[model samples]
Target: MLQIAVIGAGVFGKNHIRIYRELPGVHLAAVVDPAVTLEDTPVFASVDELLASGIPIDCASVCVPTVAHAQVASQLLRAGIDCLIEKPFAASLAEADQVLALAGQYGRIVQIGHLERFNPAVTATMPILTKPMFFESHRLSVFTPRSLDVDVVLDLMIHDLDIVLTMVNAPVTEVRAVGLPVLSPKVDIANVRLEFATGCVANFTASRVSTERVRKLRYFQPRQYVSLDFARQDLLVIDVADPAAAIAAFTQGAGLQHPSAGLSLRKLPVENGEPLKLEIESFLTSVQTRQEPRVTGQQGRAALELALEINQMIAQHAERAGLL
Candidate 1:
């Protein structure tokens, strides 16, 4: 059985601990968190303590705070342990590079916890992608004290940014963004617009101060439109059967019963599963097979780079508005 440890006992880290215990062929070897203790597993106060214990750990989930990510992950990698790190890879690009370098040097697998990538809706939408040109994404959540070390861009919007970056596969040409602090000292709500080298445009809004929770993305391609609801694990696709017929229908003011008009709508089937569980399973698979993970360190760094850029834009906007 593969032995895994969870560093940090915070909200996300506890989930990782639970999932690791539930999954077969894996043992929840230990947990490293000074503030928390568990009955079932041994708890170490720090990474140093865990390493000193020599518990035969095969892998670990680095779910510590953003600032501590690099430090904790570096130690684990140096000790020859593969890691699955939580999102916002590191506090800065340099730290992210540090973790990446360590993982490369140790010949270990590293997967970033961009959990939405494992969502069934995203998985279902990938095969139908045919040059998406426009994207509209919204991710909102009620105020929470968790992950307050970073702004909404990194805490919430980075998930969508990662997904979009993966889909677009183009260089970002321009970035325009604005954000404000609502409940926390950092930006709690923000709007970002990105232009890509392939002429695609994307608009993203992320908020941690909303009254309701929402996680949705919609995109349009040449002859089709796709909608994804991350929370519901739902995917909807609408395809124009014939562009000429669609145009003619609009021009001729044809009724719904018009024989020449053609539009097909489908609700794609999604095999919904707990995203975290799937993410961990994928991470474990990569660790076992010595293969690259679904979300590699490089991809995580790319998302972090863009999120940092957007944060810079937000700072500039705030300064211009005299809010800083």
Candidate 2:
């Protein structure tokens, strides 16, 4: 059985621990957290403590604070442990570089925890990607002081940033952003627009001070318009460019109106599964096969670079508006 250790036991950390425990053929070795304890599983104050205890850990999930990601990941990697570091990769690009270098030196597999990439909606959207031209994304949540160490861009917007980057394989040519701090010292609400060399444009709005939670992304391409609901694991695709296949399906359904007015409407079939569980399973597959992870260190760094750029633009806008 593959032995896995969780490096944090906080909010998201607890979810990781629970998922690891539920999966078969994998042992939840221990949870490394000084502040919290898990029943039946040992808790180590740190990765060093766990290593010193000789628990035979094969891999670990670094779910610690953003600032501590590089440190914890470095230590584990140096000791020949593959790691799945939680989102944003690291607090800064330099730190992300260090984590990448350590993984390279140790020849260990590394997976960045961009959980939404594994979402069923995104999975279903992948096969239909032809030439995306425009995107509109919004991710909003009620105020919480959990990740105040970073701004809303890093806390919430990075998820969409990663998704957009994966979908649009073009170089970014322009960016415009605006953000405001409502509940904390850092930016809690942000709006960003990105233009790519391929003439694709994307608009993103993220907020941690919203009245309700929302996670949705909609995009339009040459002949298709797709909507994804991350919370509901739903994907809706509308195609008006091709009416032949649409009309046939509509006729076969006995005028059921599967397609309306030469428009093909489809709710794509998505294999529903918990994103975190799928992420962990993907990491384990890489570890066992000695292959590259779906979300490589390089892709994580690219996403982080874009997020930092958005933050810079937000700062500039904040300065112009006298919000700083």
Candidate 3:
């Protein structure tokens, strides 16, 4: 059995703790948090305490604060323990590189917790992707005190960012963004427009102070448009094409705005399940098989890098608008 411990006892960390206990061939070795304690499990004040306690830990989930991610993950990796660090891998690119280098030296599995990639809708939307050119995404949630340390770009939009990066499979050539702080000192809402080297464009809006919760993404490609509801675990694809449209026009304009006489909309089949459960299960599989994870540290860094850039753009816009 693989022995595991959770480094934090916050909302996300508690969820990880619960899921680990339910998965097969894994033991809830310990819960490392001085502020909170879990019954029927040994508790430690910190990773140092957990390491010194002599409990055999095969792996751990680093769900601590963004600032602590690098330090906590670095310690675990150097100790030869595989890790699954929650999203926004680290506070900055330097810290992200630190985690990757540590994992490389230790030859350990490091999975980034970009949970939406495991969402049923996203999984179902992948197979039919063909040069997606335009995208619109909205992720809104009721105001919560959790993850207020960073801006909305990192807290909420990074999930969509990772998925978009994987789908586009191209480098971002330009980014235009704007954001504001609401109900917190940091940016609580943001809107970004990205231009990729492949000529694809994506627009993203994220808000943590919304009155209602929404997690949706819609994109268009040649003769196809897809809508993905992350919360509903549903996918809808619409195919529209002009029979006489030239190959260039079909590849360039492809049903983005106006559909031809022929159009069909249908829902795609989806396998519904908790994304976190799928993520942890995949992490365990990589640990056992010594294979690459679905979301690797480098891929997570790409998302983070873009998110950080968006944060900069937001800051610039804020300063220009005299909101800073």
Candidate 4:
């Protein structure tokens, strides 16, 4: 059995611990968190204590606060432990680079927790991806005290940013953004527009202060429009039947017989599963095979770079409007 240690027994950490216990061929070796105590599992107050205890840990999940990610990950990597780090990889690029460099020095696998990438809807949409030219994404959540240390862009929007970046596969040529604080001192709502080198355009709106929770992405390609609903694990694709038929329908709008004339609509099948479980399983597979993780540290850094850029743009806009 692979021995696993979970650092940070907070919200996300607890879930990782529980999943490790549930999965076979893996042992929940210990937990490192000063504030938490568990009756069944060994719990240490800090990583230093856990490492000194000689628990024979094979891997660990670093779920500590954003600022501590680098320090904690560096310690574990130097100790020869592979790690799966939680999102917003690090507070800044330097810290992210430090963790990545340590992982490289130690020859350890590093996976970033961009959980939505493992969602059934996203997985289903990957195979059907075309050269998408336009994208519309919205991720909204009701006000919660969790992850208040960062703005809505890092806390929420980073998920979509990672997804879109992966799909577009092009350098971002332009970024324009605006954001504001509502329920928190940091930006609680943001809207961003990104233009890519491939002539693709993406618009994103993320909000933590919302009456309802929504997670959706819709993109339009040459002859297809795909919609993915993250919460429901649903994917919808609409394709034009033919170029001539589509043009005819558009030109003869009043004479069209149906609202969806010359369009073919279908829902893609999604194998629904808990994303966190899948993520942990994938991480274990990587550890066992010594393979690169699906969400590599480099990809995480790319997402972080974009999120930080968007935050900077927001700050600039705030300063211009005298909202800072």
Candidate 5:
């Protein structure tokens, strides 16, 4: 069995610990957290303590805060341990690159915690996502003081950015973004518009000051429109150019109109499942096979770079508005 170590015992880190403890073909070697006492397992005060103990660890899940990601991940990589670092890989793109370079040099695997990629709703919609002409997404959460250190672009919108990059499959040509610091010292709300080389465009908005949580994505294609509700785990597929009578019959049967009566939407059902488990399973598979993960360190760096750009734009806008 592959021996794994979990660093950090915060909210997210606890979830990682649980998953690692239960995952098949893996042994939870130790838990390292300076902030918490790991009562269920052998606990180390810090990663240094565990590494210095000479425990056999093949991989580690770095669930530390975003600011500490680089230092922790780099140390592990240098020690020849593969890693799965949580989202927004590091505080900056340069730091992310350093971890990635160390992974490459040491021939170790590194995966990013873009958990939405493993969501069942997202997986179910992948096969039908053909040449998206336009995409829109919104990820909003009720006020939580957890991520006040960074803007909403990195805290929330980066998830959509990772998914968009996967579906669009084209180089981004331009990005326009705006944000404001409504509830926190950092930007709490933001919107970004991405123009792709393949004529596909994605407009994303995220807010941490909202009253209700929402996670949704809408895709417009040539013949159909697909909408996914990550919160509800529901998918909707609508046929735009239904020219046949059978199409009309199907729509009529489903209480849908002929695109003229505003009843063109169709619902697609998705199986409910835990996305985090899927993500961890994928990471384990990559570790066993010596293959690159679906969400690699480089991909995480790209998303972080774009997120930083959005953060900059928001800062500039906030400054011009005299709200800084």
Candidate 6:
């Protein structure tokens, strides 16, 4: 069994510990968290203490805050331990570089925790994304003080941004964003529009204040419009000849009489299921065989770079609006 250490016992860190404890082929050596304790597992005040114990740890999961990712990852890498750092890999690109460099020098694997890669809706839709022309996504959640330290763009919209870049294989041509601070000094509500060289446009909106939660994506392709409800793991595909046809068809399919005539309609069946375990299994296999992770440090860096650029745009807009 591979020996592993779980750093941090915060809400998220606890989940990691629980998963690690239940997974076969993994020996939970210890859990490190200065602020919390694990009843059955050995508790160390810090990673340094656990490492000094010479407990033969093979890998570790760094579940600390974003600001502490690089520092914690560096310490673990130097100790000859591979790591899976949580999302928003680092506060800045330069810091991500440092952690990635350490991983290369030490020959350790660094997997990013972009959990959406494991979402069933994304997996089922990946095969149908053939030359997407336009994409729109909205991820809204009620205010939670836990993640107020970061802006909503990074805290929420980054998930969709990563998904969009993964689907579109072209370079970004232009970017526009606007944001405002609703409950925190940081951006709590933001919208980003990305234009790619291939003419693919992705518009995304994220908010921390909402009456209900929504995680949805709509993609426009050549002959079909793909709509996914990530929150419910549902997919809907409508086939049509053009945008006008698609809207008319969608309305007609919903039993609404269309005002326009000569509209073609086709309702494609949707596939719904769960695939979160698939991602965890993939991570385990990658760790066991020393293979690259599906969502590597490089992919995480790319998404983060774009997210930061959009955040910058939001900052500029906020400044112009005299809200900053």
**Count: clashes, candidate 3:** 0
Q: Residues 235-300, candidate 6, lDDT per residue (tens digit)? A: 777665455654666766743235342334433344554343455566677888999998899999
Q: Tell me the deviation in Å of residue 206 in model 6.
A: 0.4
lDDT tens digits, residue span 25-49, model 3? 8999998888996679999998898
TM-score for candidate 3, please give it.
Answer: 0.94
Model 2 residue 235 lDDT score: 97
Question: Cα lDDT of all candidates, in order?
Answer: 0.95, 0.92, 0.92, 0.95, 0.87, 0.83
Candidate 4's C-alpha runs over 4 A off are: 247-260
**Model 6 ranges with Cα > 4 A deviation:** 241-277
- TM, every model: 0.97, 0.94, 0.94, 0.96, 0.92, 0.90
Question: In angstroms, how far off is 271's CA in candidate 2?
Answer: 1.6
> Model 4 Cα displacement at 213 (Å)?
0.3
Q: Which regions of candidate 5 are displaced past 4 Å?
A: 243-266
Q: Which candidate, 2 or 5, has the higher lDDT?
A: 2
lDDT per residue, candidate 1, 1-324, as tens digits? 999999998999989988998899999999999999789899999999999998999999999999999999999999999999999999999999999999999998899999999998999999999899999999999998999999999999999999999999999999999999998999999999999999999999999999999999999999899999999999999888887887788789985436666777789999999999999999999999999999999999999999999999999999999998
Model 2 lDDT per residue over 1-324, tens place = 999999988889999998999999999988999998667999999888999998898999999989999999999999999999999899999999999999999999999999999998999999999999999999999998698888999889999999999999888999999988888989999999999999999999999999999999999988789999999999999888556766676667735344444676789998899999999999999999999999999999999999999999988888898877
Model 6 is weakest, by summed lDDT over 10 consecutive residues, at: 254-263
Residue 191, candidate 2: C-alpha displacement in angstroms: 0.2
